[model samples]
Target: MNAIQLKQMTSAKGFIAALDQSGGSTPKALKQYGVNEDAWTTEEEMFQLVHQMRTRVIKAPAFKGDRIIASILFENTMNRKIDDKYTADYLWEEKQVVPILKIDKGLADLENGVQVMKPMPELDDLLKQAQKRHIFGTKMRSVIKEANEEGIKKIVDQQFEIAKRIIAYDLVPIIEPEVDIHAPEKTKCEELLKKYIKEDLKALGKDQKVMFKLTIPNIDNFYADLMGDTHVVRVVALSGGYSQDEACEKLTHNHGMIASFSRALLQDLSSSQSDADFNKMLKDSIEKIYQASIK
Candidate 1:
């Protein structure tokens, strides 16, 4: 399987353009964003641009691609702060593609917090309303048994519609669903996976290719089970709180394809003293990982 890791710092739109130009190379862009030469660009700027591009593509009638995996921070407040207004604007306009709201990781400290789910009442209500207006719900995990069926159905319907659009444009849109099972109970994780696989099969049928952004632990044991399965599975391990090298080693040892060091990498790139150092690190890391996976 070919492995690709989308760094959060690379704007989705820019990345897509880069892919079009370099056939998936990370360091080059044929069309530039036309910014001042000396201006320091932050990861946040890239994220905002990507979000804007995604919104445009979603609304466009013609767009083509086989599969695209978007790696984003769901519940991290630091990630949310930059795009809050953009989300609010979409909500005001009644657009269905609202950002997935996540519970602040710190909320786990509160009493009885285990029962506290994210997607606060306001966002939850908005999602419910959006389902009525659009074919798909914004939340990806609605397929799970614990999620509201009505909502899940809407999301599935919307996904089917999007797939149709992809086909119409001669593109294949593989919905890459991701979930953070970091703190959940083992049983809960298993249940979620079962539902995910079932729904995915229903969506893709038997012989179609499907992509997923998964954490290491959730799919570790099931790796072999998926080995000759009809669909192509690409697992991206979260390297936020763990050792990136260790995670990559384990995934590669288990026959997994790609591993991402996004969080740690972004931090280093953002704080690096020199632009040359940052660029070199980004280029070298991507090449090293690509070579390792291929070998």
Candidate 2:
């Protein structure tokens, strides 16, 4: 890679955005913000509302700073136009936020305490779509509901398999094997997760690499070794269900893992608020999350 390309990768270190969510996440968010339930019934209406909401958040004046290095988008929103430009282009051209897509279909039935990705028959097409839209990377979700060896192994294998394909498409992959916060053995699961991630990364040729967006382990600083791995370009954390304060506190203890939060980053802003109010709230959240990232 050229020096410029290498520098950009290294600079992609903190506050990656995660706007690509599906299923219950949308409805849950609407309820939390006191939006009317009737407005969310149809897919058409839901997508329109979600597009508007995500657009405001992504292009808000508050995001014009350098702290938020990247953003993930849902497929539907990726194609929408804002100010006569595609959403992805607008983010890059205007705000300098890297665009990424969430490609996995939502989760399916729980099996062996692991939530599997629903059958995604169109991931290849999705990658092509993301590329056409100028997306810089892709992310997918797999959850470890329990910390058993069998469950963790299944989660890791499935994620890496898809992650491999993402790499082949010449786009970066944020491999997320999330351990549920409610799991009884969060530490054990994290240890197992580290082991499997290291092994998978080792088998790759020297040139191959991927980023990780992992759950913050129950024990603080547990992921220091993995964060320091040469093969791991960047390590980011998910908020799961934690409140903003809680998420930021735990994030401070985990060295080198910065925030890529979904809910925690959005909890303070509401659709009912004025645009100015929303922006102010968003600015405050970004400052707090960014501070937590560097703390």
Candidate 3:
């Protein structure tokens, strides 16, 4: 997992050529080599490779360059439970690159890992509103209602708090809101989001600037809505079941911060042969993604 090992196994020349002529043929190339067709898992593997290579690069005293931002996307407590140990282990083992943990949990769960949990910033504000009966509680309807304007504002606040605490640990806290654009509750949520935006601008303090972000799914048109915002909100399209190039193209076109791929990619890697070919495939995909992301 060193830079030399990665470069040698990936074959930089072949990788570059693959990417260049990949012209949309990358999927075919990958399938021909028995690479997983699911973009999400494929992208995840690529990220893991970049992380390993980047770690090696940073350890070299002679190496000096911009740092890479590595992130993991987790949905639901199940995903969190599964990924948290892996992420924690990677963070502990890796060096240099920033670790961004994106989760779809309540503010409390988001804040649980770090210190300075008291005076819960965003959750506190949310609870204040919820206490007034101005928002929803933990019930299904309430949860849905609260995830909107009033609730989102509070979540945004909580994100700020988490970001502050994460920075103290020298890591990055990524707040990933799993917004369903096509849900029946979209109108209420949208209204709340508008109000939340105004409130966010006012509550956003010096330390909280650009530290929080919002992630929406299954919507391509909403990108325009977020374009004019002052706060940093990243729109990520779910590409788990799609083609990698299509996912990459959409992410590129929309200027997305991250693209989530299929979880199956990990399963594939786990079953992959431990021989040199497996290593080469892993290395090549990693470098390809790194180059794509940087561009």
Candidate 4:
């Protein structure tokens, strides 16, 4: 692990950028960026377009490391390049942002009120390549739709199991067990999640450490104790389905948690915008997220 990057992640005053929408979520991400399915007939072409958007965002003046400490990238994006430099290298060298990879294949079918990550048979090989490419850490995700204790326990257990393997490679894992924002039992879901997560944290070896990416809890500062755990490096909040304004607003009341937003971060950006307009919009969004994160 890069010591400087670790310090930045632990002590930085900014939010993480979740630019990791992959095969399952790519179409919607592109559509929101003003590109429709009709715009590309081939999968490769589709990825090319999305990469352009990512490149544009990375090269923008407002994407400095000061207000955006790190970026979570899809595996596809990790393998690609920006300005002729590998994506992770460019992020660290030019933008001063740490790069993290999203390694989950996708979510499994909902069972027992939760969806676990699909098997990642290629995880070891992916981790090897990530280390070679300057990646600082990794992120994986699963979802909880209700407050079932059995289901949420399974999710957190699987996450910590995978996290141990990632740590064996000397890479930090951002364990993401996202509670569905629209779940009728949202508060209860978070309660169960916290219980399971705390149990898992206690099981870690003395020197082991990891991070977390979670939904903004129903109660403000609910995850504050988790942030201070010796086993935890940082705790970041996902936007889930919240708009930029709503997500930013909620972040302020949650001390010690920082943003790791996807849709909310890119909501104002469109492929059709001129460079000047795109940069300005991204700058404003970053400023809002940054301020909220510091609060």
Candidate 5:
């Protein structure tokens, strides 16, 4: 198979499986799988447990991306071997999804809300490593809860700030500005997001491009502005706090956006299951998400 660039990853077909949990939700997921978090006093202690979960989670029954997931965004720490091969290599070898890397250092608080990718001094080195390993793209996140113009501005500004750097390194940036689904201004905030993102991307060089990882808006097709933008290769939706059923319903309503979900994608999966059970759960989730993505 040939290498996949950022544009091709989006423009070609299918949704993105946002499995780059970054260990942020690992404890909760592990607990759901019947793992005891009380014994592991430190995150590092749970490394093997997380990797075990990842291995099981990634054994997605092989399928074409035609009506399924186009790619996967793997956690930065998941570069190690699975079944005597790198997990990314296994995914690529099986022709399941384009493998990607998550390079952000995680979120930090702004005066108003949340901003992602704090103190990412080593991101350049990481991208070079991903390139060497043939990872397709990267995903970073910033979140907004309500309509604070200054906070929204900060979110977009910071996103483009890192996006330009990622492009320079020849990686597609999945720019995520996640608005809380329950926010009072869900509709209003989405309108503001379109405005800010459009303004921000217009300032970039003509050759520049980005994929958006957005929150599902209250109304369907609420992101026509972004989906229509030439600079936007694709728009992918995040589950935020929605259940799988609700998320799938909302995702189908949006014309251009596809699912790039984390929790929603893994909710039904558990580490305690046998290999057959785990794979069955994956197939079920993939089927549901695939149906939604093509809708």
Candidate 6:
């Protein structure tokens, strides 16, 4: 583990950038950036286009550790390069932003009103590769659609189980069990999610530490206790389909959690914009999110 990155993760006054969109989400991410489906046919070409988009974002003047303390990268992105350096290396070396890799294959089928992560049979190899590339941590996501205690428990347990393995490799894990913001029982879902997380925290070894990426709660400061727990590094909130404005507003009401936004962060950017226009837009977005995070 990088001691400097660990200290930054725990005490940085900035938000995380969720640039980890994978196979399924890549096309949507491209479309929002003004690249149409016809832009690329082959999966390799598709990834190349998305990689170009990511490169633009990373090289932008506003994308430094001053406001973006870290960034989450998809597996493909981790293996790629930015400015002749590996993506993770460029982030830490040039920008001072910690690089975290997304490790989940994707979500499983909706069962028991939740979607646990698909099996990651190659996690060990990937973790080894991540270590070689200087990745500081990992992020994996599961989803909760309702307040099914059994399902939520499974999600939390699976996350912590994998977290322990990642920790054994000396990498922090950001456990993400996202509660659907539109669920009818959203509050109840968060309540149950918290209960399960608290239980899992107790089971962690004394020296182990982890982070969380969760949906903005229905109640302000709902995860306050978790934020203050000794085992937690930092608690971050995902945009969870919220617009930038809405996500920023909600973030202010929560004292400790910071933002780890993807859609909201990129919504204003497009391939059509000039470099000047693009940089200005990204700078404005970063300023808003940075202020919201430090509140």
Between candidates 1 and 3, name the one with more favorable TM-score. 3
What is candidate 1's lDDT per residue for 1-295, written digit by digit as tens?
A: 1112212211122111011111121121112322232332664454444443333332232211111122222222112222344332332233322222221122112222122222333543433333333211121221222233343344345444443433333222333222333544534544445454556456664534443334455444454454345554333334424454555455565454444444333323333235455456554544444433333
The candidate maximizing lDDT is 6
lDDT for model 4, on a 0 to 1 scale? Answer: 0.95
**Local accuracy of candidate 5 as per-residue lDDT tens digits, 95-175:** 556676777777787556545547789878888887777676677887787788888888899899998988887777889
Writing each residue's lDDT as its tens digit, candidate 2 over 36-93 gives 6797668778878887888888778888538788888888889898789999889878
Q: 3-99, model 6: which lDDT tens digit per residue?
A: 9999999998999999999999999999999999999989999999999999999999999999999999999999999989999999999999999
How far is each candidate from the true structure, as Cα RMSD in Å?
Answer: 13.1, 1.9, 14.2, 0.6, 2.4, 0.6
Model 5, global lDDT? 0.75
The segments of candidate 2 whose C-alpha lies over 4 angstroms from its true place after superposition are 1-6
Output the better candidate (5/6) by TM-score.
Answer: 6
> Which portions of model 5 miss their true places by more than 4 Å?
1-8, 38-45, 62-76, 113-117
Superior by lDDT: candidate 1 or candidate 5:
5
Model 1, residue pairs in steric clash: 135-158, 136-155, 137-155
Each candidate's number of clashing pairs is 3, 0, 6, 0, 0, 0
Ten contiguous residues with the weakest lDDT in model 4: 75-84
**Local error of candidate 3 at residue 254 (angstroms):** 0.8
Taking the tens digit of each residue's C-alpha lDDT, what string does model 3 give over 131-213? 23211111100022233444566644654555544434323233333344344665555456545555655665443323223
TM-score preference between candidates 3 and 6, better one: 6
TM values, all candidates: 0.42, 0.94, 0.43, 0.99, 0.90, 0.99
After superposing all C-alphas onto the true structure, candidate 4 shows an RMSD in angstroms of 0.6
lDDT of each: 0.34, 0.81, 0.34, 0.95, 0.75, 0.96
Better of 3 and 4 by TM-score: 4
Q: lDDT for model 6, on a 0 to 1 scale?
A: 0.96
